[model samples]
Target: MLLTSRSLSRLGHWAAGLLTGLVAMAAHSAPLVMAIGDSTLFAPLQLAAQEGFFAAEGLEVQVIGCINGRRCLKHLTDGEAQVATVADTPMVFALHAGHRFDIIATFGSSSRDTALVARTDRGIAKPADLAGKRIGVVRGTSAHYFTNVFLLVNGVPRDSVNLVFIDPIRGAEPLLRGEVDAAGLYRPTGPQALEQLGAKGVQLPTLRPYTVMVNLVAQPGLSQDTLLRLLKAAQRGVALLNGQPGRAHELLGARWKLDARHAAAQLDGYEFRLSLDQTLLSTLEAESRWAVREGLVESRAVPDYLELMRVEPLRALDPRAMTIVK
Candidate 1:
């Protein structure tokens, strides 16, 4: 049927409105680049990207996986990614190095993730046996800090053992090749090393002094709306992790090519959620002081960590999750 002039005008108006809406959506749908670490500690980031959570939130996210948090944060600092996944150690070291950035939120944390793995045949059946042994560590990362704290808590002096610097992604290699008697490792690497070593590899006992905080950091000057979208997507990823454990395990296992049992074991021990809290600030300050005392950084005084984080985005998302004072 031929349309009347009046109906044709109405159809034209409807088509114009549709075109305007599509243009606005296209403008806001710019691809967001996130440089994420390979550890399960940053599982939320991976889940968000892989499970279509970010896409569901009208975001096109590109994930660039790094060997460790330090390199992930480097991708952000070098202008490669708008967002990065990192732990407390790299942020402290970066701040001391004069690089400005913002911590949007901490997505996960765990006390049991970082541990010392040793070859039992090497007579290292216990933490005290670590003395004078060449210990492999990823220098300047959370594993390095945990190695020191593990030693101190086990009554071994810091300088007593030799620390063999190892690559972050290949943290367990030195111990696997017998280059170092023990290695302080985090997830994926830790579990993988133990599995490869079978009964010969043992995780030494410790007080578990440090809890690695997996954080989402943003490059300075990112728009708040974009940051909020990223956090919201991450929050959904955390929900999938907590709400659907079996699916999360399966998906993560498939992503990393681990068997179901290995994936479940590796993914255990973490509390995945989005928050900006006092404990994070305290952890940063402690790491900062440790860095200074160890001569890792030139700055003697601890920088005010509050300046390094922007809690408004997280607060806007969930007021209850914003527990950090000021």
Candidate 2:
């Protein structure tokens, strides 16, 4: 959680100092970032703030939690935030719309980040059971891609099912009320669905090749110095998470509104290794193709994602983990 014991004093101090007009956020704070709100995809970045990882790097990050990637992108585009956190799927779509930015780091995964949940009584015991059924998802987003990919990988033709576009927040509600046969939901909404349906809810298997890549994006011309400091802090955050799973799980439970056991269980579903690897490249490429094919973008051409990746920060932080893309 970003409000952990180690982080309270700094945040509280900032809050308390606001009345004096001393919180010159733009002048005093290190660059600001708008991260997806309460989204599991950006946990590493949140952990970086909560565990004093950013402070250890001599950087003061004023983090704003936006509700989703689209909003985060807005913050970056409008110059309200120096950096933004979003998944690769939306990143590709935004790029197609001419959002000039560079990917600084890739973190998190979709191993269990997205799930195809079915109401047990719907008789969706197998992947093929979804044919001709209604599957709800928030259209043109990661959940949308997950829904199609889930069906395609499972040999359930995309056209065989009815895809109803619904907001992810209440996406599961329809399923619980027997409004939709199934839904493509992501945490923490997936857990909400499971809680509502109990034994009646089943999460479909995650498609490894289709895992979503969470990334940090910065508006053009961000300083190399600033980028490196932020990444060094993030790198430490990853180490802390790996070194202290017990404490990490406790934090996750608080942030995600899950029990300790549930938090631990959810922890296994993601890999928080921040890097700009072939995995990220391939995922972006695939998502671009899907976005274009689905008419989600105005341009049919998929930009060279490599050019969008800025590797200097990661290379400086750990050259051993950096690989030449071309």
- Candidate topping lDDT: 1
lDDT of 2 by residue, 3-60 (tens): 7876898888878889556655545555556454457767777788787787777776
Write model 1 residue lDDT over 184-288, tens digit each, in one string.
Answer: 998878877998999889988886567989899998888888888899999998998899888988898998898767777887789999999999999889888
Q: Where does model 2 exceed 4 Å of error? A: 1-31, 205-209
lDDT of 2: 0.77
Model 1 worst lDDT window (10 residues): 165-174
